[model samples]
Target: QHGTPSSPGELAHHATLSFSYLWAGDEWTFTDARGAVTRVRVDPAIHASNGDLLRDLAIAGCGIVMQPEFIVAQELARGRLVPLLADYRTMDLHLHAVYLSRRHLPGK
Candidate 1:
């Protein structure tokens, strides 16, 4: 964790943290400024389903974690965690808020 990598190629040498519930848990995908896509296969030393746990591990310098910005915002701001590969774009996964109409509600 001393020398944080600044490029996608450097990720292979570092340890990774994977989310067990994510569809592409072991695969990290990125898009460069040139619109080139690169997929990296990471063998995580630790796998977990909880984001909080992964954040904790990353904050403790266990390994790099791919987590939502909201989850690690505080730690990152406080310098407890550092953001890497700022130029590269990762997958944009979002949580959608769904609402059901009365007709679609239970036994309508």
Candidate 2:
């Protein structure tokens, strides 16, 4: 029912939303303009493992979700979702590709 959080401290006043096992703890870290890092933990009103579902919920005005830009790019472009905390930056996500060793591969 309230608007988006403009700062980390404001997160507590609003429903800090999240999704996925990676954000299971409902803790979010952000860097301020001065490069000061802050971590905010909240008991999410809703939690799920799917980003899409979370995005949809956020669009439906459930709460503010910390989702990837790509996941909500379309919504943001269409003015469905407005970005919050422009002054804070979230941590980068590192993804690695894993594969079986050549020796473990079966002959075709």
Candidate 3:
């Protein structure tokens, strides 16, 4: 993947391929060091509701995917998938946990 682009402008010269997931929208947005934003609308090569499947496809060299760090952490550590556009930051994803009242919680 020596020809792979590291910047948004260069990426545009290549096919904007991606693997689709239900929660992930059609756009891949990145904010650069100068605070400039780049929004990319991907041409999906595979559409899957499962993140694992998407990650697998990416590992198989199907196409590029924007997956959560936790999901691809092992692959990244093993050098299976290389990080791109390190200088840019992606949008933050917020997660929330819900449970019953504290009174219903078990005592430890």
1 or 2, greater by lDDT: 1
Q: What tens digits encode model 3's per-residue C-alpha lDDT throughout 1-108?
A: 438777765654544345454466677789999999998766666667677888888888877777789989999999999998889998786668987789977899
- Which lDDT values do the candidates have, in the order given? 0.87, 0.83, 0.75
Tens digits of lDDT, candidate 2, 39-108: 8887788988888999999998888888889899999999999989998898887658998789977899
Sort all candidates by TM-score, best to worst. 1, 2, 3
Number of colliding residue pairs in model 1 = 0
RMSD of each: 2.7, 2.0, 3.7
Largest lDDT belongs to which candidate? 1
Clashing residue pairs in candidate 2 (N, C-alpha, C atoms within 3 angstroms): none
Reference-based lDDT, residue 21, model 2: 61
Quote each prediction's TM-score: 0.84, 0.84, 0.76
CA deviation > 4 Å runs, candidate 2: 22-24, 99-103
Q: Which regions of candidate 1 deviate over 4 angstroms?
A: 98-108
For candidate 1, lDDT tens digit of each residue in 1-108?
A: 547887877788898888895578688998999989888888888999999999999887789999989999999899999889989899888689988667856873
